[model samples]
Target: MAKLFEPFTIKNITLKNRIVMSPMCMFAVEKEDGIVTPFHVTHYESRAIGGTGLVMVEATAIEPRGRIRPSDLGIWSDDHIEGLKTLTDRIHAHEAHAAIQLGHAGIKAQTNDIPIAPFSEEGTVTAMTPHMIDQMIDQFKVAAIRARKAGFDIIEIHAAHGYLLNQFLSPLTNKRSDAYGGTREHRYQVVKKVIDAVKAVFHGPLFVRISADEYHEAGNTAEDFIYFSQEMKAQGVDLIDVSTGGVVNVPINVFPGYQVAHAEMIKRGADIATGAVGLITEAAHAEEILNNQRADLIFIGRELLRHPYWPKVASEALNVELEAPTPYKRGWN
Candidate 1:
């Protein structure tokens, strides 16, 4: 069997294959109400029906002010739970594990409210007070509760792409003099608290997406992420979904499998499983990564967007028999 088609298990969750549909925001909430819509239901359920092992919902905001855009999906309240549950039910009905990326955009939030971050930027963003920080941790805990109530099998913390948690992790943006700043461990305090808070109520396979390479001279390097990965492993995180370059936008040289090296480094350095993302579109490359023990899972982003039935394409390319959904079996292969 192709490694890409092999089952992977972490904690109590088992993925039928290594292909993970990377979380990409659709920005399709037409009413700005932060509720799941028909478009989202169709968008994600199509990938599950296409044979994706794990269908990750987009970066869902934990609070309205934390959204990256006005239309991003949300899990901040109990009202959001019903719509999300409907979506998860569809994915699970297709035999795919459902996961949600809980995130807060912080200073990068595009909402009308004053954005919050680790440090205050003059007239730009507000520094979170200690009480606010405590509240933020509780918000993540509450979001996890909603995810469980929504019937999601996994929850991924979005700490990458220069979002709220990434703001606290990267020194380029986190310029604080308090305990949540200065040293690497200090900078990690907020993320650590967030992880602990989520793990308190979430027992499923917990994943964290991190910007392993900050793309700046003073930013967190591969070595720094090795430390972060170790800390997350110790805290019972099941996987580190490795993706790079979002903390501060610098031009990145794009290529196929460019970020796979970072995932491999973290896997070896911290001895933790990781999901390799960033331009990984080919099945052979994904198999090679897993076959060689470089990374445990392959996260396909744009390609999956372009081709919802990407796993079938991968199975054909890898010479594996991919069983299509019952109704489409005669037309498939």
Candidate 2:
């Protein structure tokens, strides 16, 4: 097995370690205008300094209305680039590569505020129109360009978590009868364009975050993901970030490595690199995923949030490192 702390390379970018800081929306941004705040920079900086190899910033909306929360960071405008640049520079200084996850919330848009269609009996989200969908595609392109200016080494498209792209993949949510919905290929058209546009602006590796299974009572299936992953790989996606079950109306019962199955499936089924996320906390568990070749990378979310020094601690626990961070060297006993 390639040890978890060993450097891993994808394309021209070589991560100092296999540990990746998965993007988690903290809703820490102050406004919906997509401006990067000091809080966002500080939040990510902590992780970078903790010794993560790839510090993927949180889910940044590509457009204003496409935002999931009122305070989500965005890369839609030039104004957002400077703050993002500060984040990238800080992470780089700490020997970590920076990545941005660009996405639109789609019909799941504005979960924190505003109104749209197919509202619950209590009234909430509304389905997006064809016009809104088209605008989102363009927004993704513009956001990708902004990310490049901000000095991101990689751009991951958020197509998972039952957001806009996942909604389209679901027969339950996507009721559109046009080219935007129905059938597998037509449902994926919007995201495919988003990927293509982002690739045009980003010169480095590209990643596509995907929900391998919608896990809805009546929802998109693993087969749906297989088809989607295949198309995504064909479109030049560098890796598939596999996660599952974000659209459930009730709490989901899952165990550790529950989502790893999705990653394993996509990696083998599509013959592409996959990043396994969710409940991947322990060093042994992450190592197992790599040893089995189930995933190319292990993305830790809540665990990293709880212990920013997870990589360093894990390296020590695995007995694989010569020393810990200089400041924390004494604490590494």
lDDT of 2 at 91: 92
For candidate 2, lDDT tens digit of each residue in 104-141?
77656765555442223334555567776677778888
Report the number of the highest-TM-score candidate. 1
TM-score of every prediction relative to native: 0.99, 0.92
Candidate 2, which segments miss by more than 4 Å at Cα?
111-127, 326-333
Best candidate (score: lDDT): 1
TM-score of 1: 0.99
lDDT of 2: 0.82
At residue 195, give the lDDT of candidate 1: 96
Position 117, candidate 1: lDDT? 92
